[model samples]
Target chain A: MTTEKMIIEIKKWLMEAAGYIRVSLTNELTVSQKSGRTDLVTNIDEETQSFFIKKINQYYPNDRILAEEKGYDTIDSLTGRVWIIDPIDGTMNFVMEQENFCIMIAVFEEGIGQLGFIYDVMKDELYWGGKNRGVFLNEQKLAQPNDVSLSKGLLGMNAYMYGKNIHSAGEIGHASMGIRVSGCAGVELIAMLKGNHIGYISNLSPWDYAAGLVLLDEFGFKYSNIEGKPLTFTKREYFLAATPTAYAEILENFI
Target chain B: MTTEKMIIEIKKWLMEAAGYIRVSLTNELTVSQKSGRTDLVTNIDEETQSFFIKKINQYYPNDRILAEEKGYDTIDSLTGRVWIIDPIDGTMNFVMEQENFCIMIAVFEEGIGQLGFIYDVMKDELYWGGKNRGVFLNEQKLAQPNDVSLSKGLLGMNAYMYGKNIHSAGEIGHASMGIRVSGCAGVELIAMLKGNHIGYISNLSPWDYAAGLVLLDEFGFKYSNIEGKPLTFTKREYFLAATPTAYAEILENFI
Candidate 1:
């Protein structure tokens, strides 16, 4: 199948996985710890990830899979297609609030992100983007933020990043009219798409940035490391995203 | 009427007011700005606060009201009953995301809290408490958090607080396992009650603290100004709330 065909298939599978996972989450069940006491992993994350993995294996037996809750392993076939999935991105929010979490899936062909999808289960909002198709929130097309300066714009950052990394956060905050942290990346990314925020910065995993990156490209937004380098799927930390103008200013002032 | 009868009547009034606000919000009307672009005063807030004020005036006749979007005005008869209300606690969140905001109201008689009610309208969850009556999330009674140390507890603060007041936030974050800011005081208070967070610190107005204060009281939690003094209805700048044990530790370590 062509890359576009594969992406279309992945998007459909993601929606089905989201519905299955959301149903399981709505039912009250005991939760277990994954990384720490606060970092919980429900049965839904495992079940949904497995469901997607099985579908991918059946269709593209040569593709590799990297999933949260399940350790990553190499695929011997190495057909240049790898699927990265985070069944539930905001597990802490999910375990405590049962909202604000999402199912993230990204497909990379020959080490380039070909397709990215973030499915917000509770709201049933799908954010999807690809190299050719650009970005989309459900069916509507997405746009990058305006060329507003940082001081005139809103910013989204992780609460810890703002608190622990005061120097960087202050520089960004001083450059922006206000700073907001809603505790979830998928929500923040969607806000950025709508111009509610000019930029969003966080320590994100591959799955966290997968869908957002595709949307950013579609909207003509920019995403890079703090040092203004291109992002790689292997390294999952410290990424910044913004409109072209804001990105330049942030890079010039903060980094 | 007896105090219990009065409390029950007020609770019913609150639920009815919430219903009115909820119906109007979900009716597919477009939202407009009143204060500023980032600040949104929805019709729901105005209509709900008006409804509650009207109900209180009709029933009590001599009570005072201090509400957001409405200036404080004293009652001539001074029957010592005062109702503090935030028709929509997270107006920005409500306008942008239509979730996580709440209707907050607290009734005080002679400077003593008589009732506190915060309604998470979307979730149909009511958080209510008083000195005599225990705190509750819907029908489930809430208990005070265990004596978790600051190092192990979660602290909630707005991103602006960390940016503008980094010294204090840095101390708080370093002393705690993590920091979370959900951008809404009512939502953060629920997290505190659920033990997901040990404390929340913010520059809050009376309307924001009114309902939350009652919950803290009944749940055996503690709250005070940054200087560790009692919080008054007139104060609006800075306040902190936590489990009793965490409060002491925070005062010693951060304050």
Candidate 2:
């Protein structure tokens, strides 16, 4: 019943799920398209989701599930205990490189984030925390990244953002130390948490970033939609997750 | 000495230098700006070059060196035995993430690429070979990547390229499966070689791409400047390295 017990249980479950991904990585993967030719879905994505769904139904049946491949469109309420899961965040990266994709899950109770988990499968590094617990990478508690100015920090951006001149994403490109694109939302968000990148400018779906948003809030990061509005965990929007000073600099000069 | 004999000894030296880098990575690094605030030079960059210089001179004093930080910008000849070294290819990535950066070296004789070595330090994966022996990742000899079309491929691009539009880089974004940027030329080029990315488009100086070009050439990749000209290796130019079908498709549809 205790949050401490829940945290311990969640960590063990995450590591177990990650173990499945690692073992199956070398197996022949079946990949197909979603949305369009570029958007992809692999067998691993479906398998991982089924694994979580089966486990959750058996262990925590009452918890509402909003999973990427299934049950996402059916969610009309954020009430009760809701688990938002992105079984595989970077499916294309997974199908191709089999290196950068991740497994993400966020537990929310009555619309408040109770816990968040991001497992970088290839690296086996678990990033988890929310609210009172503070963010953590593996076991080490992370320190708050300083509010660095845009010019003093590198930016992790969506590659498409660079060409969308209307948003001044290209102008920000010239102002930062540099730009990097990892093609994975969970990994990019973790980079911002570690201070490897001061901010990430992106447009992502809910499953791609909900788990990361919880960790960002715990680390005191300024993350919001492009209009500087708070994320609602539903609709897709242009997102900016950043340190304070960096966020101000990007908004003032670039956006 | 035979080229075969030289390669055998040089691989040893490269691994030893990489060992030093691995050990010294955690030390306090002092960074200074070069060209502008964004371009950086760290003490490790200088130390690595010195380590290479001392070892090279001790082993082959008669050979010429054109290194990124030290002997670079002084080369009058590409003739004779010349070592083109980028002590650390992704300096900013090295300073920020302490990963994704690499040690790249290319050995040329009489304007011909004789041997090449790119050490992905954190992974301890060495991509090495030349005109004669063929490219190998670690001990595995790499086979040529299939000629996938542009629409089916992912392009690793310079984050800045997406905005330029001059090279139709943005158009290519729509044509490829997606665009990713690693902010490191050496690693990006390796990605292209492994088929994780079908191509890489960027404007890079010689040391930024030479060693990888050797590997690309051995792998039968088609690479050239934006105007479809050969790279002079003395100046920066927009470059494209891709599989056969992907190269042709990008050239026709986007370029």
Candidate 3:
């Protein structure tokens, strides 16, 4: 199948899987951590990840799978495709508030992202993208955000980034028009898609950036390391995604 | 009438007024600024403030009023009763996303806070408090937060605080469990009421703090200037609010 065809199939599968997972989340019982008192896991995260794995294996048995709750499974020498999944991002928000969390999925073929999806189940906002098709929120195509300077733009950043003094991300927020930390990277990415923010900077995992990176790339937004280099599949300590102009300004002044 | 009766009346009036304002926001036509750009001000904000002002006038003709959008107005000379109001806090959030904003009201008698109310319209959650009645989220009474140390607690703070290097609030966040900044002070205070966050520090106008201050006091949360002095009504700069234990920890290590 062509890359486009694969992405379309992935999008459909994501919608179906998200709906199932959301329903289950509403009814599933929660479990606390094995070590820490605060960390929690719900049956929904595991069940949802399993459901997606099952569907992906049924469709593309050769694809490698890496998930948050479930460890990596290597598939030898069949195809160079890997599915990265975060069944529930913002699990804390999910367990306590029942909102702000999402299911993220990304398919990379031969180390190039072929498809990406972030489903905000509670808000019913589906942000998806693929090679050549551009980014989309639901059916509407997303525009690259207006060319705003760092000082004039709104930024989505974690409050901890400021506290931890990570690469001056907090300083960038002070220089911006305003700062918003919504506690969920998936939800914050949606805000970026809607032009509510000019950029988002965070310390994120593969599952966190997999879907959003594709969407940012498709929409002509810039995503990079704090030093303005392109992001790789390897885990990164910091990533910055922004409009082209904002990215340039932030890189010049802070990075 | 007794103070309890007055608070109940104000709460009911605020709820009805919010419903009216919400409908107006949904239906009213908006116009752009002469600068030829979208300058958003929903009719809800104006109409809601007006509705509230009229209600206060009819019920307590002797009370003074201080409101956003329309500055302070003195109605009577002898009575030292004042109402601080923010018809719509988080107006940007309201105009852009139609969520996370709230109606905030606080009553002071003889220069002492007597009652406070914050209505989360979309979720139908009402947080209210008074000196004698304690704090409440809807009908449930709130207790003092757990005596978690700063290292074990979460904080609600503005992300820009770090960039500005103001009060070193970000450092305090680093010392905590994690940090969250929700953009809306009213919504953030709700998190504090639930013991989800130990404290919040922000640059706030009187309206923003008016309602939250009473709730914090009733729930045994302490608020003071960044220097650890009591908060005064006239200042708009740095202030810290935290559980007593967390406050002591923060003052010792971070402050």
Query: Which candidate has the highest TM-score of all?
Result: 2
Superposed by TM-score, candidate 1 places the C-alpha of residue A146 at a distance from the truth, in angstroms, of 6.9
Superposition TM-score, candidate 2 onto the true structure: 0.95
- Give lDDT tens digits, candidate 1, residues A52-148: 8889889999778877765652233324877878888887667655677878887777767778888888888888878878677788887655766
User: Which pairs in model 2 have colliding backbones?
Assistant: none
DockQ of 3: 0.30
The sequence of per-residue lDDT tens digits that candidate 1 reaches over residues B6-56 is 778877987898778667765864556665665667677877888888888
Q: Any idea how many clashes model 1 has?
A: 0
lDDT of 2 by residue, A165-242 (tens): 547777887788888888899989889888888898888877777788889888777878876877777777788888
Where model 1 places Cα greater than 4 Å from the true spot, the runs are A1-51, A68-79, A94-99, A121-126, A129-153, A164-167, A193-196, A252-254, B1-48, B73-79, B94-98, B121-124, B129-131, B136-148, B164-167
TM-score for the A chain of candidate 2? 0.94
Which candidate's DockQ is highest? 2
Candidate 3's displacement at residue B209, Å, is 1.5
Checking candidate 1 for backbone clashes, the offending pairs are: none
The stretch of ten residues in a row with the least summed lDDT in candidate 3 chain B is B31-40
Using all chains and alpha carbons, the TM-scores for the candidates as numbered come to 0.80, 0.95, 0.79
Candidate 3 ranges beyond 4 A from true positions: A1-51, A73-79, A91-99, A121-125, A129-149, A160-168, B1-48, B73-79, B92-98, B121-124, B129-147
